[model samples]
Target: MLIQKVRFERSPKLHAMMTEAPYPVNARVVVQGKRGPEVATVRDEAEPMPGDGRYGMILGAASEADLDRWAELGREAEDLKWLLRARARARGLPVKIVAAEFTLDGSLLTVSYSAEERIELGALIQDLRGHTRARINFAAVGPREQAMMLGTLGACGRENCSSHHLQDFAPVSIRMARDQQLPLNPEKLSGPCGRLLCCLQFEHTQYLDLLKDVPRKNARVCHDSSGACGKVVKLHPLEGTVDVLTDAGMMQGVPASELRVLKGEPAPGQQKNRPRD
Candidate 1:
C-alpha cells in the first residue's frame, strides 16, 4: 500500500490516506473522508507510515459521473447555505454561516460557522435535520478559520496566507510586532482575519538574529569610528545600523559593528545591575 496526501475542496489542511496504487498529482479521487466517500484532489505522495490504516483508504479514482456528481453537490451546498442563514435568522441566532459541504453520496451535510461566543445549536440542528434527509453537523470556527473559508485578501492585496498555501497556522504574538519595531495600533497590525498578521513571523527570526548582538534602544554606547560616546536612539536591524544621539546632541547613523556598550550605565528603561542581552 502507498500513502498520498489529498485535499478536500472545502478544507485548508491536507489529509494523508492509503492508496493501493500510485496516483499522479492533482488527480481527482474518491477517498473515505470523515463524512464518508468524498471527492478530493491529490496533493502529493506521502511516505508510508506504520499503522497507515488509521488514515483511511482511497476507494479509487473519481469517475466522470463522480466528477459530475461532485459539481452538482457543490451547487446544492450553495443553496443549502442560504437556507441555513435564513433559518438561523428566524431563530435569532448569532452565528454567521461560512460554508456548507456534502458527502459524495449526499449522506452527510456539514456546515461551518463563526460566532462571537459559544452558541447552543441544538434547536438549529434540529430544525435543519427536519428539512434535509441528510445528517447535519455544525462546525464552529475562529476568526482566522472564517477568513480562510471566505478567501479574503490581506493588506498586501494578495490572497490570505491561511487561505492560500499555509497548511497550518503558526503562533503569532504581539511580542513579534514589538520586536520588529512596528506600531502597536491594532488596525495596522491585524490582517483580514482581525488577528495579528501572519507575515509578522516571516522575517521575525532574521530580525532576532540581527538584534542579538546589537544594543537595545536608549542604551549608552560609544562609536568606534568617530570615537564619540552616545546613546542608541533607534535600530535598523535590516541594515545593520543604529541611530546614535551623541553627547553634543547630534544624531548620526552608525554601523552596529562600530558601537560598543558603555560600561556601568544601563539603557534608560533597563534596570541597574541587570546585564542586557
Candidate 2:
C-alpha cells in the first residue's frame, strides 16, 4: 500500500488515504469514497505505512486513456451544470448548485449545492443520472464553502479567505468587531460569505491584551502634569492616546502614558477611540 493525500472538491483540504501506490502530483486516481468510486487528484505525499483499514484504497492510478476521458468529462460537466439547473427549476428545488466534480474514470459525479436546509433531490438525481449516465452524489455546503468552492471575490476585491489560504472556517461574531473598536456597519464587517470578515478574529487576543493599557471611554481620569480631572471621551488604542473632557469643558488629546485614572480602572496598555461624551 502507498500513502497519498488526495484532493476532493467536497473536502476543505486533502483527504488522507492509503492507496495502491504514490501517484505524482496532478495525477488523477480512483478511490472508493463514502458515495462510490470517486476521482481525486494526488495532491501531496503522506505518511508511509499508515494503517488505513478505515480509509478507502486508491482503486488505481489513471492511465493515459483515463486522462483523455477525464478531459472529455470536464467539457461535459459544464453542459451537465446547465442541465442540472434547468431540471432543478422545473422541479422547483430550492437549491443553488455551486459546482460539480467527476471521478477520473467518469463513473461518478458529485454535485454540490447550497440550500437553507436539507433538501430531497431524488427526482433531480434521477434526471441527472439519465442525462450523464454516471452515479450522482449530492453535497450541501454553506455560504463560506460555496464561496470557497467557486473561488469568489470578496467585498475587498480579493479572492476570499476560504478560497485562498484559509483551510477551515472559524466562528466570527460582531463582538470581535466591537472589541476592536470597529464600526458596526454590516457592509464593512461582512465578507463575501455573508458572514463577519475572517480577519476580525486574527488579532483579537492581541487587541484585547493591548486594550488593557488603555483607559475606557466615559471613565474619570487625571492629567499627569496639569492634575485636572476629566472624563474619558475617547481612546486611540493603537496610538496610545486618550481624548479627555476636562471639568472646564476643554478637550485634550493626550498620550496614554501621560494619563492617570482611578485605582480600579485599566492601565494604559493600549489606546482606543474616545467614547461620545
lDDT of each: 0.83, 0.77
Instruction: List the RMSD of every prediction in angstroms.
Output: 3.3, 4.1
Can you write out model 2's per-residue Cα lDDT over 1-277, one digit (the tens) per residue? 6677787654546777786567788788877776666667888875675553567668888677766776787778777877889889888888898887777657778788888877888887888867787778888888888878878777778777777767678888777787677878998998877888998998988877767777887778899899988888876777878889999999999887778886766555534443322
| After superposition, candidate 1 runs with Cα above 4 Å error | 50-53, 265-277
**lDDT tens digits by residue: candidate 1, 1-277:** 7789998875568888888888889999999966798999999975655663578689999999999999998898898899889989998999999999889999999899999888898987787776679988898889888888888888999988888877888999887887787878999999998899999999988877777756787789998777898888887877888899999999999987788788875432343223322
lDDT of 1: 0.83
TM-score of 1: 0.91
TM-score of each: 0.91, 0.79
lDDT, candidate 2, residue 123? Answer: 81
Distance from true position, residue 197, model 2, in Å? 1.2
Clash tally, candidates in order: 0, 18
Residue 40 of model 1, lDDT score: 91
Q: How close to the true structure is residue 34 of candidate 1, measured as C-alpha lDDT?
A: 68
